[model samples]
Target: MRGLREWWRDLTDLVLPAECGGCGRGRTVLCPRCRTALSGAAPCRARPVPEPPGLPVVHAAARYADEVRAALLAHKERGVLALTAPLGVALAGAVRAGLREARWGPGDAGAVRARGPVLLVPVPSAPRAVRTRGHDPARRIALAAAGELRRTGTSARVLAVLRQRHAVADQSELGARQRLRNLAGALAVAPGGDRLLCGGGPVVLVDDLMTTGASLTEAARALRAARAGAKSAVYPSSAGEGREERKAGPRMAGPNEGGGVIREAICAAVVAASPDSFEINRN
Candidate 1:
């Protein structure tokens, strides 16, 4: 089934060759200039206004403007799957910057091996959005990012364990506060997800773009809830376990041991963030 799907997609692409999503250049999904634009010189912090509670510190590879914006829309809304590779490369850079900011040390083999594999958890897409697009763009980019991370000696893997627990209204027309209200309590961790997060490596939420940051904030909440639930299950109210769980905090711990109550994401990475979020760094 997978092989057939791959062949069909390849054939479809050949039948309808793509132009650069950033520019109108023919015969390419993304031009070199646009790819470079997507990949900023360095990853930088991106914060949305009225940042929601539980929102993690975010890093983005580029501002969501001009070519970057066009490219993201093309890949996400238009199903230009070929753009995933370049976008993933951009995301990988942002993830690396996040790891550095979090003080995970160098990407050397020894350092990465010692730290185990970081988990890239892509923010879940609404069911309606996924159905309309016919593919989950965030997950595809996340998979590519993980591959890119592995090549750079930073052990990483994608864990798509977040799911929407309820429906949400379209967010494009909503203001920041409205978006927050709409998304609150909309997401939850899938069964068995907490075990993966407890694997002693930091969890970095991945997204294609971030505007108001409500989604990421909600995702962090879901993950923390899952961790807490898992810990409670194992500890079962023993005094010693309670003490240990309390000490665990939000830090990732060994799979066998509980990590306490997760309150926020370690960090988040995106292909781009709103242009306004980059202003401080620009100055």
Candidate 2:
């Protein structure tokens, strides 16, 4: 079934040539210009100006403007799904670097050890956005990343543990602060999924872009809440931090629930950072 689907997709691409994601030229998914532009791997932090609370260190493969942004938009928003392979390769490279940067040892890194599984959790997409796109782009990217990880003799998994409980404003026009505010309570981990997180492995969050990182931060929060619960767990926290359940907010989750200890995270994407707030590492 998968083989046939891929064959059909290849046939379709041959019939309808796609413009180069980088240069917008016809007959290619990525043109020479974009290929050259993204040929190298340079990872840098996509920092927050004010830097929201619990925002872990994030490393991006390239700047998000020009050809990089073009490639990402082309593949992600435009249904240029064929680009997943190239983007996945690029993401895998970034992830490997990020894991190295964090200094995670062999047994420490989830993707390295054969004993435990590595969970790549993607930031959830809003219901409306998913409906309009007919699929979840980030989730698809995560799956591609998992495939890349497995190809290199690593055990990986994509845990779609995030879900939106309510609608929120779109992030296209929002500034960093506004973006943080808009997504503050917009994510949650579903019930009965905590066991997957506590199974003892690394949980890396994957995303297509990192604009201020508000979404990923919230997603990490959900993971933290989930990881806080283990069968033979430590002592419970104080009242405020206790697992006082509530109705699912825009995004709500329980405590002690996590995908295990996230020794490090790698936020990989096809393109560079956006121009407005992106900082490239010239080193």
Best by TM-score: 1
lDDT of 1 by residue, 1-283 (tens): 9999999889977865558889868778777888789984788888887777668778999999899999999899988888898999999999988776665637344654665788899998988899999999999999999999999778899999999988899999999999999999999988899977876577899999999899888988888888778867877785554555576656432232254364333679999999887875655
Best by lDDT: 1
Task: Provide the lDDT at 142 for model 1.
Answer: 98
RMSD of 2: 8.1
Q: lDDT at 52 for candidate 1?
A: 73
154-192 per-residue lDDT for model 2 (tens digits): 677888888886789989899878988888877877876
Model 1 lDDT at residue 120: 94
Q: How far in Å is the alpha carbon of 52 misplaced in model 2?
A: 1.7
Residue ranges of candidate 1 with Cα displaced over 4 Å: 1-17, 105-112, 236-265
lDDT of candidate 2 vs native?
0.65
Global lDDT scores for all candidate models: 0.83, 0.65
lDDT of 1 at 275: 83
TM agreement with the true structure for every prediction: 0.84, 0.76
Clashing pairs in 1: none
